[model samples]
Target: MPRYRKRKQATQRKNLIGSLLIFAVLGLVAFLAFFRYELQNKQLAYDTETLCPSNITSPKYVALVFDKSDAYNKIQQQFLRRFFDDFKANLLPGTRISIYVIDAHNNKEIAPDFVVCVPRTGDDANALYENPKLIRQRWHERFEQPLDLAINGFMQPAQADFSPIMEVFQTISLSAFPLGSETVPKQIILISDMLQHTPEWSHYRGQMDFSKLQKTLYYQRINTDLQQAEVNILYVRREGMEKLQNKRHAFFWSDFIQSIGGRVTLIEKIDG
Candidate 1:
């Protein structure tokens, strides 16, 4: 009887040891699995751009939005959203560019990505749209000039959010970028109703006073200088009532596409 009891006690100890080993292995696996999950999530964070061979090396594409209309100033956010939905992912293969959507009036970068919905904050759109030379200069210096200083100063104390623009600039700054291509494609997609009312024109055509605009030709004409860009005017289409107060941004963005150096397509969608 004593020998049998000793054997039973030994067997019980063995079983306990086995269970602990199994638990230890499971805990290790669970820890490894959780660690991998975190790593992948960090890897897939929102990237402003992805690389591909069809790169144009344009100075860099800046998604410019102008929320300057007092008439639609409160509702200007709609246009910015529509712009993002149309082109954010469907962008041409190999085409990578940095994006910036600004409250053109305030010069504050309101949206960083393909943001579709934003509340309106009425402010005049500034014209320092996307010229690298202008960006390099001190923004406050822009106000010191005798020009429409009132319309041109920065709304917030921050200088400028050129990080996206600068990243591309550094990437392409190497030996002639888009390596084989002799010409670099440069563009600034200005999204606005093309309205300015500063009472007079400054030498810089796109700058507006934001206060003096009349509803007629003042807002009708977009800055014509886009003709100078290597591949200018990746234009988006817009049309809707001002009082609607919601971003009626059209998802049907077919009109704004151009090859690295190809002629700008002037396609437009007719509302059915």
Candidate 2:
């Protein structure tokens, strides 16, 4: 009887130990699974924030201003291709993108030549469940497909025309893009030669007297506060410009842009 009792106690201890080991293994697996999910979710949140941070009320806005006067060079084409190709990845749901042309004569009356407002389809919530392929497909169908068509049609080569860049700038700054919700951010991407070719202050003719121009009708009439917006200039260099001339051009634009509400974040020159 004593031997039997000892054997029974030993078997109970072994069983208990085995049960504890099984539970420990299960717990570790559950912890690992939860950790992975949390990590992935954190990554998704960060990506979304970097692309377009917004709240329940406000949405992000981006404006692509193409200078119709600037010749569409090889470098410009390459840059535009890359920009548009990567555009979908950098946008959040409900972000608006407007495409406009900077021409002296045409598109002057109209503020933004083309406007596209992205809709929220709640696809972002499925980031964990959906594969990359399906997500890409959804992006194309919703935003990228239409944008591709618009950009292709707009980028066709045209004669170098007069650039009413100041007028375009004023229009964009004053009323074209309104201050939507205080939380929303604004962006303007200017693809141009950074040369002002208007009658009031023509960079092609001579040096611009910014102080004198500020007191004139053209400047006073369109005083806009674009401090809330970020301006990025993808500078297209014109042929036959000396080093000094290019510096002057940059100075005129950078100063004028700063004088107004626009913040010049980047002034990158595109080369072939």
Best by lDDT: 2
Q: Which candidate is the best by TM-score?
A: 2
TM-score of each: 0.27, 0.69
lDDT of 1 by residue, 1-272 (tens): 99999999999999999999999999989988877775553233232322222222333333332222222322333443454456443443223343333332333333333311111111222232334444324222421131122212211123221212212212222211234434444444543332222334321243322333324363333212222233223223235433221222211111111211223333222121
Query: How well does candidate 1 match the true structure in TM-score terms?
Result: 0.27
Task: Please give the distance, in angstroms, between residue 109's alpha carbon in candidate 1 and its true position after superposition.
Answer: 17
Compose the digit string of candidate 2's lDDT tens values, residues 86-117: 76666767576777887657444656676665
For residue 240, model 2's alpha carbon misses the true position, in angstroms, by 1.6
lDDT of 1 at 102: 33
Q: Looking at candidate 2, what is the lDDT of residue 42?
A: 37
